[model samples]
Target chain A: MANEVAADANEHGSGGGMPDPMHQFEIKRQVELDVFGIDASFTNSSLFMVIAAILISSFLIFSMRGRALVPGRMQSLAELSYEFIASMVRDNVGAAGQRYFPFIFTLFMFVLFCNMLGMVPYTFTVTSHIIVTFALASFIFLAVTVIAFARHGAGFLQYFVPKGVPALLLPLLVVIELISYLTRPISLSVRLFANMMAGHTMLKVFGSFVVGLGVLGGWAPLAFMVAFTGLEILVAFLQAYVFAILTCIYLHDALHMH
Target chain B: MPQLEIADFAPQLIWLAITFGSLYLVMARIALPRIGMVIEERRDRIASDLDQAEQLKQKTEEAIATYEQALAESRAKAHAIAQETREKISTELEAERMKLDRKLLDQTEAAEARIDAAKDDALSQIKDVAATTTEAIVTSLIGGKLTKRDVSAAVTKALSE
Candidate 1:
């Protein structure tokens, strides 16, 4: 998506020859490879995902090496993240969700790290891509559906039919409920991807303004960029929280069906 | 937009699967459980510490109770000993007093006997004196002296009257 915009900017001869704001989102192949003829080339996006994985693993694993009775700063951070997700599962999904803590925790850390890493200059925002978010969302949707079927069997379909509705309107309500239910993945994925992409794009646009405007006039946009960066950081954390919490909510719906 | 590039999706998904799957394994197998164990261990340690504290407190209370019991027992014994000693002294004093009273009574009776003997001796002397004086007077008046026996008998009759 950003590659197309960068090309357009290049063809148009960008105003003041400023770098394309969309160029940062371009997917450049770092190590081209063929995995069973599948073009599984290693790209900047893959690099960041690997970095996110490594950072998350190392942060959680190494920080907890001490296992102190009284936690230190890093250890406290690790514990706080753990408890944060743990409580999210407990509060949103109940005790039944305890078994799924690791998965939820992983999803949160992955998305959180990706979003945060993207905030750094010259880093690719993996979650900015719709496909990535869609993958995660669809996986959650599939897992939740599987869990619903496993737990409630055919009774899971009853979730579409609301109780206390007029019998005459039941068919219409069921169809609406089914549509909404089917759109869960789309909504979930787009919500995260849109937020990440939009925030980053806004930051890039303002950054270009800062560059295009000379030093005297650039301060205004520069200041806005600073404040907006803070907000983007907040949005980054919030989106990850939303992603994980929604997963919990969906799991709750799947498990409890109400 | 590179995001819409279907060509990039495969690699991204493949890497995502590799990285995310491996991360999940690390978390589930190594990282998460270690954290959980630490937390669990801390909880257990705290619970055991509380149990130990409670036990120590109970022991302290028991020790205090025992000390108090011993103190009360000794206090009662001390009271009993003092009471016994006081009663023994009182009885001893009473016996000593009774002995002194008997000795005083004996001394008074002996002194009275001595006084009576002294009075009797003086009275005998007075009779003899009276007999001697009467003989002298008769001799002087009638040119003759009465016998001692007679004088004694006359003195005795006068003393009796």
Candidate 2:
């Protein structure tokens, strides 16, 4: 907010110079609360995360509160969300993953909403942050790992050893598998974060070109921005879907040890 | 950027948990089941409606078949009745024709018999007249008292000749 105030003040001085595109991702302190030096403040990121959550809840609850048999537009959207996640879970994990439907659905909707909300001009994207994505990914990883251990006992370790590999190559393959397994959270977190950051940055760059090239020459960049924005929207939905499905696959690996 | 800052992790996680936890609760508790139920209910309703439609169509087809069968039955009955009536009328006509034929035949036989009797009577009368006439002629010419037997034999001979 302080930077925004300064930016607003500077717009008057510089006659509409373009601000840094990455600046939009900055977290502004909304309510400062430092508990034991944790600096656990409610920032803009928290605000948007809450907004996304509330929006998701209300969008679902209110839209389907009537639960019309022939669903209207918003209710149809609600149901679409439900089926999309349900099918994702079922496809990735099969019947055994049904119990995790709520979690997968929640994660999918949460990430989807966060990514889409970031598309707004000044909105903060929570999923764009490594902290948020990593937290989600790590939680999923831990849960899946625990589930694997609980379900398969010591046999879960066999997942790291391929069934058809020669005994001589088994140790090397095992190490590779272990490394890949350990990198799940990192890869999952980075995939979403990097995509969101890169897409937003590209949009910002194109957007700057549109603004910097005046009304006469800005039409090309403007059109490109329009097209790029559409692509980014698709990316947003895709990233969320990717996140959810990967979690399910990880969950399946844990449950079936395959 | 603030996103890379290590200090912000706690706040992000805390709020993520707080909000996402509620979202999950609402989804599992209220939203998902309702949506699932609505979808399931719609699918079942469609299936049942299709079943009902199929049943009704079959019933209609069966009714048509039954009606056609009855029509065919009634048509056959009418044909049989017409055939029976025609045969009865023809047999009655045949009997009447035979009765008329018998009556006409008897009338014709009576006429033929009468004609024959008349013809025979006429011929006998003619022969008697001839004999009498011949005997009278002979008496007139001869003018003598002749025996009756001789007159008779004379007349018979004349006639035989």
Candidate 3:
């Protein structure tokens, strides 16, 4: 459905260039009307992300409505997502952090749904873009910083101070702590974005070759396509898991700071 | 091929920020609280049910004990009543046999007195008859012989006495 709709768009009109798989990442100016002199670009990536958000919300809400003791498949899936994040947060962040279970579970489910949504053909993989991943990472970074300050007050600054360090090594330890703190958002974002983009790009390259080779000569490309598809699916789930776990670790740093 | 422009990345980041912020707010404010409430409510309900079940079990055991105790008391009372009634019947039978023995002894004494009186009357009559017979025989025999009357008279007097 996504491909046919995009193909129809291409057939009826010109969007100025041929559709590269990366073309979806390009920001298109959507509303002619500007707000506060800032323009909104509702690109294909943004559109698909919106779709993913709506899909995830509706899926969980509808699945949980009856709240049956004996769960159906969808309810079980929703519950599994909940319990998985709850356990992850508890293990990493400890008992004090259990209060944040709902937030962590939501984060996991949303990212997981969005990641899986991109695997469908012709849909834009928003996490493939640095901007989407960076935004998520920044949110976590800010939230942890806020929680650290809220919980510890002036003591939050102690995160940069090393425990049991020799006076001679204090300078070096502070620098290391500062650098690690600053790099959290960057590493968190890059890990997800790079993995998603690289895997999808590989799949596209092999897929096109399979098509270009046509029937008799397609065997090699077909095999590559199958293996790559499986790998991409694995990467999708791994990226979501990595995103969630990293958030938990960050939360742990905020709560414990040791 | 045209190089990608820097401006292309700007709008993407802006939209990403907006979406991310919106998602965080919605989760923190709305969805999380509702889910937490549901979970807490379920926990409370289960705890209360368990407490009620425990109380009911304890009460049931108490009732069973009370029932068993009452049953034991009833059995003891029945045994005592049976023992008392058996003793009463045995003593009543002993009293009845003693009364019957006394009446039998009195009837045997009255029968022995009547037998004594009848025996005395028969003995007197038999003596008188025996004397008359002997006298006639003796007199007839003795008449042939002189003075046979005197010997017969003396024999009759001795028999009478």
Error of 3 at A173 (Å): 3.1
Q: After superposition, how far is residue A93 of candidate 2 from its true place, in Å?
A: 1.2
True contacts kept of each: 0.80, 0.86, 0.26
1 against 2, candidate with superior lDDT: 1
RMSD of each: 2.9, 3.5, 5.8
Q: Write the per-residue lDDT of candidate 3 for residues A81-182, one digit (tens) a residue.
A: 666777898899999888777667767766776778888986777787776778778878998999999999989888999889999999999999999998
Q: At residue A231, give the lDDT of candidate 3.
A: 85
Report chain B TM per candidate: 0.84, 0.70, 0.67
TM-score of each: 0.92, 0.86, 0.78
**Which of 1 and 3 is ahead in DockQ?**
1
What DockQ results for candidate 1?
A: 0.75
lDDT of 1 by residue, A170-224 (tens): 9999999999999999999999999999998899888878877869899999999
lDDT of 2 by residue, B40-83 (tens): 99899999999999999999999999999999999999999999
- In CAPRI terms, model 1 is classed as medium
Look at candidate 2 and give me any clashing residue pairs.
none
**Candidate 3, which segments miss by more than 4 Å at Cα?**
A1-33, A67-76, A98-102, A220-224, B1-5, B108-161
Individual DockQ of the candidates? 0.75, 0.58, 0.18
Residue B91 in candidate 3, Cα distance off native in Å? 2.3
